[model samples]
Target: MRTAAELKYGEKGIINDIDGSHPSSRRILEVGFTPGQEIQLINMSAFRDPIAFSVRGTIIAIRKDEASCIKVL
Candidate 1:
């Protein structure tokens, strides 16, 4: 039940689900973070507010708040 935000740098995870009620859920999905997708933490900002993830052949940067809504394992 861990969230994407909880994944350590360079760790990989499978997307379990994204909170449908979250405002950024749609945007997240559009970026290829759909359920069952494989994702990896690629980078993080200096303050760790925004984190970069590798998924579906591309890198995506999302705020920590929005990332927390994405459950992973």
Candidate 2:
């Protein structure tokens, strides 16, 4: 498994798991970052701290730190 943070821009993957104990995990889940969901790295900010993604029919942005806790296949 690889982390969502490792996905390059425009890359796509299926969510395998998320480290639920992480502080922001609940908010991530609430935004539809769940297992078996398809996610695509849509874009990144100029500094790349917040990365945009297309997931579960919506577009959301998350920081690299939070993205690291999400595992993908």
Candidate 3:
């Protein structure tokens, strides 16, 4: 499994598992990023700072660092 940001643009994947501890992991869950959920990499800037994605049918923008914590299948 890889991170959501690691996914190529327009790529889609199901959430497999998160490789992190509490708080950050808990924060992701609170935002609807759960195991088995679908996610898509929408867009990225030239700097590749905040990557956008569609998660649980909602468009969400997050930093690459945060996306790295999320493991995708």
> What is the Å distance of residue 26 in model 1 from its true position?
0.7
For residues 1-73, what per-residue lDDT tens digits would candidate 3 score against the true structure? Answer: 6888699889999999876663477788888888899999888878887888899889888888888888998
All candidates: CA RMSD in angstroms? 0.6, 0.7, 1.6
TM-scores, all models, native as reference: 0.96, 0.95, 0.86
- Model 1 worst lDDT window (10 residues): 23-32
Q: Give the TM-score of candidate 3.
A: 0.86
Per-residue lDDT, model 3, residue 53, is 83
Go through the candidates in order and give each one's C-alpha lDDT: 0.94, 0.94, 0.84
Candidate 3 structure lDDT? 0.84
Task: Give RMSD (Å) of candidate 1 vs. truth.
Answer: 0.6
Show pairs that collide, candidate 2: none
Q: Give the worst 10-residue stretch by lDDT in candidate 3.
A: 18-27
Screening candidate 1 with a backbone cut-off below 3 angstroms (N, C-alpha, C), the clashing residue pairs are none
Scored against the true structure, residue 35 in model 1 reaches a CA lDDT of 95
